[model samples]
Target: MRHVDPAGTGRAGAQAQPDDHPLPTPGTLPDTSVTDPAVNHHVNPRTDDLAVNPGTDPAVNPGANPGMNPERSSGTNSGVGRAVNPALNPAVDPDMNEVVGRDDLLLVTLDTLRYDVAAELAAQGRLPNLARHLPGGVWERRHAPGSFTYASHQAMFAGFLPTPATPGPHPRLFAARFAGSESTAAGTWVFDTPDLVGGLAKAGYHTACIGGVGFFNRRGALGSVLPGLFAESHWEPGFGVTSPTSFEEQVRRAEQVVAALPAGRRLFLFVNVSALHQPNWFHLPGATKEAGDSRETHAAALEYVDRHIGRLFAAASARRRCFAVVCSDHGTAYGDDGFTGHRIGHEAVWTVPYAHFFLDHGEPTT
Candidate 1:
């Protein structure tokens, strides 16, 4: 069985014609470093962030101690999977209060991408689309909240994202009101309802979703659960996990959605890129789906997706100011010690790449 990340600290959309504004390069964004943990240390039960322990949180259900992860962590190899302590780490991007209504939000999930693969490719210059943020944003190793799309995404939409393992606890930036949590940081957005879509809706942002795989397809009873979280969600057969043109088709719809939105209306756009999920043999001539899931295949698929992502970047370039989160829900195992896919326990399945950056069309604000 693949080993998912233990509940650890870890911590969208619109459409219609885009305004003529060009993506402005803010002089410099404020560092995302959070306030001293000492201030956020006191847990307030009245707050909205979820407070379950990663190991024992029923929502995540993985083991508690990350030190026991046999495959990745050992006494001898100290650099492989170190958690960046949230207490000391600064926020990589602006907080909700800063961007919510003022800037459009674009949330992107790169399904099944591994940390090592993404880093290697980016280092090799194969991902120019993702490279733009390298100088000003973060590209750190973040542990996934779950081992698969359904489980991981649920945690994300709830605002319980992957935590850096630096030793101290990191307060959540946003959370569902249902959990009765008290870990929300100051200025964070706390949802009064279970669904975050409801929270964003309250803030006047037009929320939309573009589904990439079956889990978000809305084709059946179970498939609709995730997509239903948004005010508007869309999917097509061509966007399935294995479809060769999945990214291209998704970009087409995204372009339309961005182009049709009326000016001055902020968007909360969510997208799940499924091309790298599975049965990606089409990326490699002789690879078989049964055994085609590999780092090699993942790299090729990432390049393909990155190219398409550039198109969305182009569309977002027209907005006044935009905030984006580009990350992987979880990594996958390619026969590592015989673990072939995600969902159980494997280091490769838990570690993912995370980044946060802003795109603005106007000058910086004081």
Candidate 2:
């Protein structure tokens, strides 16, 4: 389903999602996304199958308990003997598999962060958190797959992050199956499922999502599309794209999930950081949340996001065998070339910051 670009563009764009709907608290996340007759609607804080807790944060702290059993992922429909399914077999010892150890993968998409803003922050050491992991990794500028969240993510989950400009051939770390590209590249992880979430599940990883922006809120039929790909998904009213404290709330929840994972389990964790998206004037000095977004405000927002990201990185770094990919979904217009918002063709909205690196491990390997 294609949606008209919120910023107004003549070209086709991503489908409109329930991001326009009133923000719903966690647990009470609207069921308007998509309803399968077979989908269970029961939700209880005590039940593991559909337990959801809403409005649990009063302050941002990364060490809080998740307050629930870590979600166990069942295998994708593909037929293969998976390594572990302890939820089904309580007697199975998780440590028996010595050959395969922790392979936790993390993807943090900085929603609506501009490339130039990031580069500026990195150079000034303002992003000292993510900067420590930048050595010998891919930090080049690239065009986003789409100008907005819903559109770009569809391409990203298909194993396309952002392609390098002036490129003859670009190497991909994770490759999704497509026609004619039947052969696998050396040292590259290959996925044959409909999307990366399914692919990771086939590889014996428990996948989860912590959403930030409205597009990811699981509000309407299209809203659930991305999060639905995971075994478990999380979102809250406080995690909205415009919320100043959304990233902090996300980190708190992420810390819970990370610590709750049973030993010897691999995690595929995905998050969308919404602080820099819009209504970002709150990040600027003397500017309130009610003010319009501006280049000055956007830069300040990135700094706010980076500070909390430091906390998140420290938490994830403590975990064993974790890998991370941090990038922006797309940039927004800051009155450049007379463009004030994203979606129309402009370099400000198209270019984004991208970095794929490993965490909790030693030096990154190619």
Candidate 3:
């Protein structure tokens, strides 16, 4: 299920080119000491900025309640199988407007994850971190815009994320200013630029992209397009499909990126998690080298991903309240209907898991 390296190297774990621009030095970055919740009582300057903008309505800016009291969560928690109340906790609410413009944004594409597998793993307590954080403690079944990474991500950056399985004209969480967009609602953060990255940057966000799959590896012109949209982009062999610890490395890098941002700068962090894509047999317990990838290994990869993703959520939230969109770009076929992979129309390939939630400030970094 790995994409051929755009650099023509054919290696899934190709070395990435160095970033064109280096990150700011520690002294140049805004003081991030307010990450401590105890001293975070001061109002967020970004909230006031959005509020004063005549173009931004209060409904479009949800900074009024930047931090929702998780203690007020009506959901029951039993460690591995917790039920989250979307109404009480802004984090699990499907309403994107609840925290979008007001909070730092985190978009994580769980590459190649299928909806059925994600749901079943959460139910079985195999994806405990996700089960504990996802809205209603479940993955929302949706249809991917494209059957593969490159096409799907292109659409996502243009504000065409996976649509709900139920219907059309679904209000998008974010949108670019286009004349005939039916999905753009009153609450949608309509940006003047063509792509979300540019629009967010124009709106004062320090956009960053953490690459995982080949399309984002920056190995060639085609591979560089997506990541290039952001103000800062990063990739390497450890963050690619072949690495067993891709998600951990991505999270570690993400934490550093967040820590280095100016205190008042809003962050728009996008991470493409590649561990669940393919060559996932190693995630299974005592799996032999000859074992082929199957639905079993796919679920195991997701479980491994769930174990490490919590640190990412914690890091983003510790800096500021964050609105996160976590989902799969598309699913892969494991010999279903005689199909072995994606890029063709198939039930397994089109159906992916999706969810959006808030990360309250000062949450545990683990």
Model 1: lowest-lDDT 10 consecutive positions: 39-48
Question: Which pairs of residues have clashing backbones in candidate 2?
Answer: 33-220, 33-221
Candidate 3: stretches off by over 4 Å: 1-101
Give the per-residue lDDT of model 3 (tens digit) for 1-366. Answer: 112233422222322234522566877963211111221111122221222332332233434332222222323221212222223332332444445446789999999998889989888888878887777788899999999999999999998999989965566767666666666544355555778777766555667788998888766769867876765667788888888888998898888777866566678889999999888888889776687788998998998988888899998887778888999999999989899878989989899999987778987755
- Name the top lDDT candidate: 3
Q: Name the candidate that leads on TM-score.
A: 3
Clashing pairs in 3: 91-358
Q: Which regions in candidate 2 have their CA more than 4 angstroms from the true location? A: 1-102, 136-138, 182-184, 289-291, 361-366
Note the Cα lDDT for every prediction shown.
0.64, 0.62, 0.71
Query: How does model 1 fare in lDDT?
Result: 0.64
**Ranking according to lDDT, highest score first:** 3, 1, 2
In candidate 2, position 175 carries an lDDT of 53
User: 61 in model 2: Cα distance from truth in Å?
Assistant: 34
As a whole number from 0 to 100, the lDDT of residue 14 in candidate 2 is 46
Would you give me the overall lDDT of model 3?
Answer: 0.71
Predicted candidate 1 versus true structure: per-residue lDDT over 1-366, tens digit per residue: 011112311111122123422445698643221211221111111221233234432224422321122321222212222222223233453445445556677888999888888888888888877876654423678889999999999999888777654554555555554333444443355555676665665555556688897898765658867876765566777778869899898878777667756565556788899988986767766778677567798888988887768677666646666777788999898888888889977889999888877765642221
Model 1 TM-score? Answer: 0.71
Listed in order, each prediction's TM-score against the native is 0.71, 0.70, 0.75
